[model samples]
Target: MNKDVRASVKVGGQGQWSDHEKWLIEQGQQRIKTLMPEVYKTICRYAEKDSNVWRIVRLGLVGRPDQFWACEAGHVAGAPFTQFKRAVEVSRLIARFGCAHVCMIAGHGDLGGT
Candidate 1:
């Protein structure tokens, strides 16, 4: 059986989205639609299937994920929920399996040959 793990972290603060943040989310969605139509369609389908509501969650940190896509289903037994997160560029490569290869493919320059 699968178990859900919930942990708490200090959020620092929360505020309304700024113009740039809103624009970034818009642009990100557009890019996803264009570049990965299948993924975008999957998100839409899940959103509709789980709940007819799509939510964009804002994180309180910059240089991190700009937006998170989730389907909102009110408290119910065996409710369906799904989340998608934006992928960012890898800035540093650590000594791990396939790190060097991934860094090369991502064009993050050589990381001292890993």
Candidate 2:
């Protein structure tokens, strides 16, 4: 629930949200609503029924995952502590290189696909 552990970081050394950034937040919120309505509703509850109240900040020093969501306000007693991470698959690697290569690198198995 702590800020550092949550990977929350200031944008451009300023904790302010620009118009474009706000637009991106709105788009992300909408995507969550469409993909996972239940979770989106829960986040809205944490934001006090206003999705716009939720702040979208950048996370630092992480790879693979494109985004990470965490609620500091929900970390309090009797509240829900939830976290979500979004990641995208590499189509080029999956198609051309194949899972065998990825699996070996990921410690799943060797090139034989065992």
Candidate 3:
């Protein structure tokens, strides 16, 4: 998906930052505040103060248009569970087998792929 919207600026680590780091953090916070509310809202919905995990999956350390994923902490209980690919497979399976097979398919988890 398009990461033109992001929660990176608000990626935890606040209050304990140094002056210079705080400035940068504020800039990121500003970016989120001033530039992208849709992204920010998504972040708010998926991210939490002490729960949830938000990781930016980029090609390298930094750049643009990276993939951002949200893990429902309660769902996996601390394990990061991304349904990006799994969701796709479920879609395909349901197309063929119908919704009744969802439990059967989901029970297989990664569908033998990782």
For each candidate in turn, the TM-score is 0.36, 0.31, 0.32
Clashes of 1: 0
Candidate closer to the true structure by lDDT (higher is better), 1 or 2: 2
Candidate 2 C-alpha RMSD relative to the actual structure: 14.7
TM-score of 3: 0.32
**In candidate 3, what are the lDDT values of residues 1-114, reduced to their tens digit?**
223323333334333334454444344445544555454454454344412223332111122122332222211111122444565665566568654211111112235323
Residue 62 local lDDT, model 1? 16
lDDT of 1 by residue, 4-90 (tens): 101211134345456565554455455444554544555555455443113321221111322232221211111111222212223
Q: lDDT of all the models against the reference?
A: 0.29, 0.31, 0.34
Error of 3 at 36 (Å): 0.8
TM-score-best of 1 and 3:
1
Lowest summed-lDDT stretch of 10 residues in model 1?
1-10
Candidate 3: residue 53 lDDT (0-100): 24
Cand. 1 TM to true fold:
0.36
RMSD of 1: 15.6
